[model samples]
Target: MIKNLLFDFGDVFINLDKKAPEQALAKMGIRTIDEEMTTWHNTYEKGLITSDQLIENYLKKFPQLTALSFQQAWNSIILDFPQERLDWIIELAKSKKYRLLLLSNTNDLHIEQVIKNMGAVRYSQFQNCFERFYLSQQINLRKPDLEIYDFVLRKDDLLANETLFIDDTILNTAAASSMGIHTWHLEPGFEDVTQLFEVKKALF
Candidate 1:
């Protein structure tokens, strides 16, 4: 039986438009999200570079840029947060049948927007759904990298077989599976996972 559930926040729970970056940047004369975006994001997610460095890199490339512009541009992917999902997650958390943990490859900017978009109360309610929450920027480790999974499993003394990891990215799912953690891929537009997994009884 699965005694723990590891959730990914971005696309799995809240909606994320993967195509938004290209669309948003296109308006700023950035024809494509190429090396600059890829390199900056990888470095930032790996905790190898600071948020400021990322802003400066882009700002230098486009002289007419402000912090707010960067914030909006970078956070274009995070769409709406559905109330039903929040309610479902909270119900599952209250069930106490399984340990709930959140693991996401995220940066400070993304989190700041979430707090702003969902108000303090809603954001707190969302966070309360997890026994523990892990963000790549804060933790200095990211998914698809073995160390992050190891960090969660070893630090929590959690057995891989007892945990179910959920992520929208196949790479992350594969990484967890390599270590024996069962995984579910939340496909784009697949809003509800109630029928997908045997969730906590409380969510019923």
Candidate 2:
């Protein structure tokens, strides 16, 4: 009865090292990421602040760090997009069994790195599989916020009961589930999106 499928881009499709950014920044003398830093990150994710502004803010704090170095640290979290997951989504799109959508809490820099890592051609192919692609930076909305979920459901005219949201983060999944949307909080190493059918068989 699941008529629509909403997927989180990071771990569900592409692999991400969530700690890489923090580790990368630590090397640049940002040993402790304070509340202000986290707030800036959230603001940046919501598109309230531009990447240049973020860089400038960080530069004001750490004048010694170069823009290129800061950019690399900021983008270190993005990793590979597995071909099998891409193939699975493409095949699923061909079936037309459900309305496919991609909802990612991502910023411009990360997205740039993602495209660079996947290659433009392959990234385009992956994007072609989705009916709509919502990136947090572009939409100015982020996950774990009810508004983002509501926006997608309302805009798509999708029934929460008939939609399945797949994400790697429990907080995100829990938020969606509270709104009556089914979710698969896929664990990174143990769960592969290519095995969606076998894994979330109850939803199908």
Candidate 3:
């Protein structure tokens, strides 16, 4: 039986315009996100680089872009956290039906934006619903990496078979599944987390 619920923050709980950042950057003359840019982003997500270092790297690459502008463009991907989804998770937590955990591949800047968008009270409520909240930058690990999944399972002493991992990204769910963890690759518009029990009824 599924005894633990592992959820991804973005797209699963909160909505994200995945292409917003790229479009925002394009307006600032950063028409292309090159290999180096992607590497910096990945490194930032893993906490290998500080937020200041990330901003500096971008500023160095595009001399015309200011730190404020770059940060604005980078944070454009974050969107609203719907009230109904928050209500559902809060209710689920109250039931204590499963061990709740949140694992997200997120960086400092994005988190700041999330707080700004979600508001402090709502964010705190959402956070309190989880037993353990793991952010990629804070944990020094990221999704799609086997080590990260192993770390979570080992740290929590959770059985892969009993933990149901929910994420909007196929790549992340696929990685977790490879390690024998149950997963739901929830499609954004077609699937809502509130219907977890109905969608994965057999597991429940």
Candidate 4:
């Protein structure tokens, strides 16, 4: 039986424009996201580098852009958190059917944007619904890495077989599945998190 529900924040619950950041960067004259940029982004998400350091790196590389502009472009990926999804999660939490945990691969700047867009009260309500809310930057762990999945399972003393992890990225879900955890790689347009029970009925 699925006793724990592990959910990803982006695309699963909150809406995200996956291509927005790159598009925004393109507008700033940085047309393609190179390997160096990807490394820096991953490092930031893993909390290995501070936000200041990240901005510094970018500013150093593309001297044409200001810190404010770079930050704005970076944060453009975050969109909005829908009300119905929040309501569903809140109701699900109240039901006490499973231990709800939120695990997201996100950095500080993006999280700040999420809070600003969601408003403090709504964000708090959504957070309150989860037993443990884990952010990649805060936890020093990012998805698609086996260590992260191991860390979560060990920290919570959760059994892989009894926990269901839902994420938008196939790489993340595949990593979790490799460790014996059940996962649903939810498609953004076709699949919504509110349909969890119906979609994965057999697991429930």
The candidate, 3 or 4, that scores higher on lDDT is: 3
Question: Where is model 3 more than 4 Å wrong at Cα?
Answer: none
Candidate that would win on lDDT: 3
Task: Please list the residue runs of candidate 1 whose C-alpha ends up more than 4 Å from where it truly belongs after superposition.
Answer: 198-204
TM-score of 1: 0.91
Alpha-carbon deviation at 168 in model 3, angstroms = 0.7
Using all chains and alpha carbons, the TM-scores for the candidates as numbered come to 0.91, 0.98, 0.99, 0.98
In model 4, the runs with Cα more than 4 Å from the true position are none
- What ranking of all candidate models by lDDT puts the best one first? 3, 4, 2, 1
lDDT of 1 by residue, 21-130 (tens): 67777787777667767878988987788888989888988777677777787898888788878888988888898899999998878888888877789889989888
lDDT of candidate 3 at residue 101, scale 0 to 100: 99
- Clash-forming residue pairs, model 2: none
lDDT of 4: 0.95
Which portions of model 2 miss their true places by more than 4 Å?
Answer: none
Shift in Å, residue 160, candidate 2: 0.3
| Overall local distance difference test of candidate 1 | 0.83
The Cα local distance difference test for each model comes to: 0.83, 0.93, 0.96, 0.95
Model 2 lDDT per residue over 39-122, tens place: 999999999999999999999999978899999998888899988888899999999988999999999899999999999999
